[model samples]
Target: MKDTQIKKLIEAEKKRQKKAINLIASENYVSRDVLEALGSELTNKYAEGYAGKRYYGGNDIIDKIEELCIDRALKLFRLDPNEWHVNVQPLSGSPANLAVFTALVPRGGVKQEDGTTSVAGKIMGMSLDQGGHLTHGQKVSATGKFWQQIPYGLDPVTETINYDQLREIAMKEKPTIVVSGYTAYPRIIDWKKMREVSDASEGLMMVDMSHIAGLVAGGVYPSPFDYADVVTTTTHKTLRGPRAALIFVKKDARELYKKIDKAVFPGLQGGPHANQIAAVAVALKEASTPAFRKYANQVVKNAKVLAEELEKRGWRLISGGTDSHLILVDTWNDGKKREPLVKDAAGKAEAGAGAITGKEASERLEKQGIIVNKNAIPFDKRPPADPSGIRLGTAAETTRGRKEKDFKLIAKKMDEILRK
Candidate 1:
């Protein structure tokens, strides 16, 4: 605490968080125990490898801490240790995903005599504009640079995943892997259909359940373990843990666990963050309790209530409503029963009026102590910096003990701010 300047900034941030209405879907507040573990003396240690197999000496304690975290992660989701292998390293979600793809998916482009190369395989994932994460093969990410992405998106009419169309694309594109879970998506994914698509295409299936990991552990959302070959999730987000990630590999004849472990350690990172691992262990244990289950269910309920209230107040909701903690509200267009915009061939907007842009709405909300991110709607014409929608989530406020009525008021406040 000798660094007065840094301490003052940290205190300022604390006050800001306390005063603001946080609706960021991928964010959550951790407990004191988790914070204590994060700042523990374990950060001084350097354990350059997995538990009991470290390259450095005097790591017995670090080994125990990591192993406990791995065990708790499996136990929280009711996974059999024998059937699943957990990698507790991989700094965060993005790297965790990269490690998985690097381990399994082939980076095509062998040199060709004609000075052109063919893509040996593709990653079939939901399009980023349609609620998928960038790690799922967006053009700007490293994953896309190394491998091609075959993007699928929501149906124009229903604003939800068209499974039949997804199957048709998978069958034709023949992707190396089909990723099911998403970042901004609010509906429950049909894991069975994704599995069938993967099967028909003879590809692997991976689920990035980072957004809903806690809900799955609480038995409120469906677990992807039964369908996915591998599952990657962040310990933060709905998990309410430290900023860490876990990669779960299903034990099969393919020996994916070995590949994933190697990819995480020597493949992607050096010594794992022992302190962060310990904190994740605490959160996993905390998430296993009955109280966390109630919290998780309440998160979904609060989201539904907020979405309903917003729609009733004339805000446009993508996909009609949400089945999870996240809600996507179209802020650029007029309210429910609004007319559609005219578009050019490139899908750029040609005409619209009498509505607020996502960026303007977000800025207005923040001035009123509300926090939310401007996001892209499905088939959005606007750029990523200021799209047509703003995403909201209930986990953080719900953790602060807010309930249905609180969220209803939040919706009312948001509606008033945006409409102005």
Candidate 2:
């Protein structure tokens, strides 16, 4: 009976995916090959340590698979094998970030023999109002609660990162870590400049590339490996793998590597989920192919076209445009006022204004088989739960083979709903 219920739930989920246009930025669809690897017999084993030095026996096969994954990841990032180390053991993106923090911060200010100090410092990244992820330093996240999190906001007039201001903040604060990544941001990051700031401040540069890892892998975006000391990413987003995460470290950080492995195992989690690792391996292999490059290019192209179409329809877009798969739409304009009146006058409810909130707007669109999440806008007057912005992306749609033509249709549908 339990197995039967699980099967039914999977069927329902498939139906939902098939019927809806999922535009959420942090979501994607994995291929069957990756899913099969996730359900393989590797989950039954318990390999506690790195490939060659496992705590348990019968780890030869697991080690080979992990090594393959690490090799592919290193190749994808164009890293020298001798100068880089890959840990394919993290359970998810959040845990991966925690591992990075634990490895970099010393326990009681004791400096390591490698000349790298363990002093804890502030983590600088995008502010909540500027479309940063919670892990980057939102007040509610563990990263914020435990560490000193200093946020850098967008230019008030342009709604984009002000690099000069960021450098000013870094010089003033002298943080130990500078993070460059986002969840809703739609522009290409200037990692080279960020690396310069991190160097001047004596800080380690880390990038949470969970949203654009596939793009980086596909050569659609600049690779952070050349400048970042460490990188964290979720395999599911744009990568189209299972729900897992990855942590890549520079080869010079040997002491840091040991600390990260320990933190991932004994410090934060127990046994590593071997199934997820297998799926991640499959996804990494898939990312190394030429076909994935075409997909990544399409994701950006689709986003740019969609943003233009929406703006042409009189929708206010934050940042003027996008260079990535996601875009932020401000919904507090004069045109949005037509929503409540259309339902009352026609005696039939409009498709997207039932509760008179962004959350309600999201729900209404979901009912029409178009999905998006209400997100907080910069300098938003509304609360986080019902912010005056919506975030849409092309990752999932691109995975489903969508392109500019599909986005034009989607923008038209969204415009009609917003106008009503």
RMSD of each: 5.9, 4.9
Minimum summed lDDT over a 10-residue window in model 2 is located at: 334-343
lDDT of 1: 0.90
lDDT of 1 by residue, 1-420 (tens): 999999999999999999999999999999999999999999999999898899999998998999999999999999999999999998999999999998988767777779886565688888899999999999899988998899999999889988899889989989999998898899999999889989878999999999999899888899998999999999999999999999999998999999999999899899899999999999999999999999999999999999998876666789999999999988876333344344577977533323677888889999999999999999888888988889999999999999999998998788777756
lDDT, candidate 1, at 150: 94
Clashing pairs in 1: none
Which candidate number maximizes lDDT? 1
Q: Write the per-residue lDDT of candidate 2 for residues 1-420, one digit (tens) a residue.
A: 479989999999999999999989889999999989888898899988778888899999988888888888788878887877788888888888878877775343557899776654588878877888787756788877767787888888888878888888888888778888888788888999888778767888999999999889888888888798889998899888898888888777345666777888778887677888888888988888888999999999999999998776665778888988888888764234424322445587544422245666677678789989998778877788888778898989998899899999998888777655
Q: Report lDDT per candidate.
A: 0.90, 0.82
TM-score per candidate, in order? 0.94, 0.90
Off-target runs (Cα >4 Å) in candidate 1 are: 110-120, 334-354
* Candidate 1 local Cα displacement, residue 4, angstroms: 0.5
Question: 189 in model 1: Cα distance from truth in Å?
Answer: 0.5
